[model samples]
Target: MTDPGAYPNPGQHPTPHEQPPRTRRRRWPWLVIGVPVLLFGACGVAVVTSVAGGNDTTVTPGPAAGDTDGGAPDRGPDFPGKLDHDTAAAAGATITRDELAYTVSPLEAVDTVLGSYLCSTVTIDNVGTTQNDFNGYTDWSLQDTGGAIRDATFGPDRPMLNSGQIAPGGRATGSVCFDDRTGATPGTYVVLFEDTFSLSTDRLAWINAL
Candidate 1:
């Protein structure tokens, strides 16, 4: 009513309580900064977990590659038996104990004798001037690893080599049988030969592989 046309437009002037447009509050800047901080925090937690687990873990060791059960090999048939001889006689075929040259064959399998018997060809050469007497069955016997003894020529089985006499420089060759009836297991058996004259002298001359 009082000269309204001369007054300014109300829409053009902002009131004291009316604020300016906020310019969308720049949401992209906050998103970029906050996203990077969140990613850094996640990576830091993962690195810390890995390092802590590495220190707590324990590594165990294994046995040496070449270690064994800690035991000595058993003495067996392959081992050569003992011989009583001087240094001079050791090299020659003649044994000093009896002044004889003897050769024995490897044990043979035979089913003729009772139970189980091992046969072999034995040759004894009298290297001395005097005669040598031998009772193959009585003089030779089987001795197992347990030291159990079994007599030879049991029942009617004749000794392949019998009690006989040999002249000087004479060689006698024949088969000898050994009985394995002592229930001793087959391992290393010491074939002991004894001189009738010297009963105390028993020589472990051969080993039966069995």
Candidate 2:
């Protein structure tokens, strides 16, 4: 027979089997912390991959210095010097600017309905390998001794300078007239010629004095 004392009271202390299962320690807390950690690690890996890919980007270069669509390199005018009467007569008042060569004859007086006008024969030769344009109305001007400037005008009795494209090594000639509103003599003016389409701002000039 077992003594009554040998078995404890059923309610005094519970056996392991009788105790409520250790409440599982709420493992959901660990799952929640671990899931966020795993997600953050994945995002870190994605950022690293994106940064690595950015290093392989390519860049294109621009056109080289002095490069042009035309075969010849573009250049400014090479002025020989300003020409006066004797030198102009000997040299024909010639000047080369960029790809064009200009020649001007001595000025002569012409009668016009508006007023007296100074006229000259103007010639242009395309010395470059590429074609170039010329506009007589806009490219020619006359400056008098009094520093007054006048643009080229039409002379009814004279053939006007033809404005158009000039092929390489080709030349054109015609008359350019400017109104003499100041009554200045023909030889007391300066003839100016420039290329309207050229990148250079220089003007070729000749003194009309004889």
Candidate 3:
């Protein structure tokens, strides 16, 4: 082997003015590389958030859990009967006094001699094969509807036509009257009578002029 200190060294200490060689890697190379990737990820998230935030939201009504409207509504204090307006009106009518019908006839307009009340009469004829049902009870009235219903009266509109009973095959005449000669104007009146069942006579009068 050569003398220990005698072999020339690849590099020696430089002069006072000379510079030393640099290492290949930087001290903070990971930070410089990672910063760009982190910035790109942050920028992507911001863009997505902005796009979503720019939209407007609206409220919408969702479906009910079950179908409740399909059924009938609760109707209290039945006016005449259990049947609705269409069903009750569609039922057939009769003339002469029968056990199932009443003999209703139209009469001349009679002013309530008692007072301002005016009454229009309609003769009833229960032309059915049975005996008259209106015997002893007075449950007669007219569904006199041409305008708005006059809820104002002595009592309910029901009592307006309820009068003395008529026998079967026997003719009974009914008079529809409104008190004070008011509210009820000139129009069509449906003479309704029910002894066992119900019967109505279509007779109209110019009872009260508007």
Candidate 4:
């Protein structure tokens, strides 16, 4: 009673093997929006290469400890001849050449009448920037230890490191004498200074003992 041409009724039109399969355009929404935009563009190019390698890191800083040349103030190491008592320069030590600094003080025998004088108390200091000219008799001296050098004299009444001119930061005490006619015992002696007419030959020594 109900077989109207084996089921193709209700205004139908599905012919070609009764089709029903053509749905393949879903590439998971471009892999979920291209894997988070390629992991947020590789974490924004690794945060701009870690902030351009932390602004090209750099530090640099060295020389300073008795500095030299560029910072000048280490005129040590040079004990030429006969300077015992552990390489001279000690009685209140403070050498610094060319730019001048000196500082002796500590060798006071006295005994007058052209004999055991020794004296001391120098000072100098013109840390350098210009004017510098000391000459306690051509820049002090008093070697001994059998090397003989003695030279600084004329201490009219003491206070006399004469031949001045020491501006930049100026300073200049005095008293130098030297002539220790071998009454020996100021720790053998060694208070030289020599910087003659400068071109820098630097000499400074000072172990006239404690």
Top candidate on TM-score is 2
Cα distance off (Å), candidate 1, residue 182: 7.6
Q: Report RMSD (Å) for each prediction in the order shown.
A: 31.1, 20.6, 27.7, 21.3
Which has the greatest lDDT?
A: 2
Worst 10 residues of 3 by lDDT: 57-66
TM per model? 0.48, 0.53, 0.31, 0.25
Model 1: what TM-score?
A: 0.48
Steric clashes per prediction: 0, 0, 27, 0
Give the candidate order by descending TM-score: 2, 1, 3, 4
TM-score of model number 4: 0.25
**How far off is residue 35 in model 2, in Å?**
46
lDDT per residue (tens digit) for residues 94-149 in model 2: 55555666778878888777678888898888888999888878888877766667
| Cα deviation of 189, candidate 3, in Å | 3.7
Per-residue alpha-carbon lDDT of model 1 for 43-104, expressed as tens digits? Answer: 98886664442122111111101122465221112333343320111111222235455555
Query: Any runs in candidate 2 off by more than 4 Å, and if so which?
Result: 1-91
Per-residue lDDT over 94-171 for candidate 3, one digit per residue giving the tens place of the 0 to 100 score: 222222332233322434445454344445554445544332233434454443332212322223334454454556
> Residue 92 of candidate 1: its Cα lDDT?
12
Clashing pairs in 2: none
Worst 10 residues of 1 by lDDT: 57-66
Off by over 4 Å in 1: 1-96, 154-159, 181-184
TM-score of candidate 2 to 2 decimals: 0.53
Query: What are the lDDT figures for the candidates, one per model?
Result: 0.54, 0.65, 0.38, 0.64
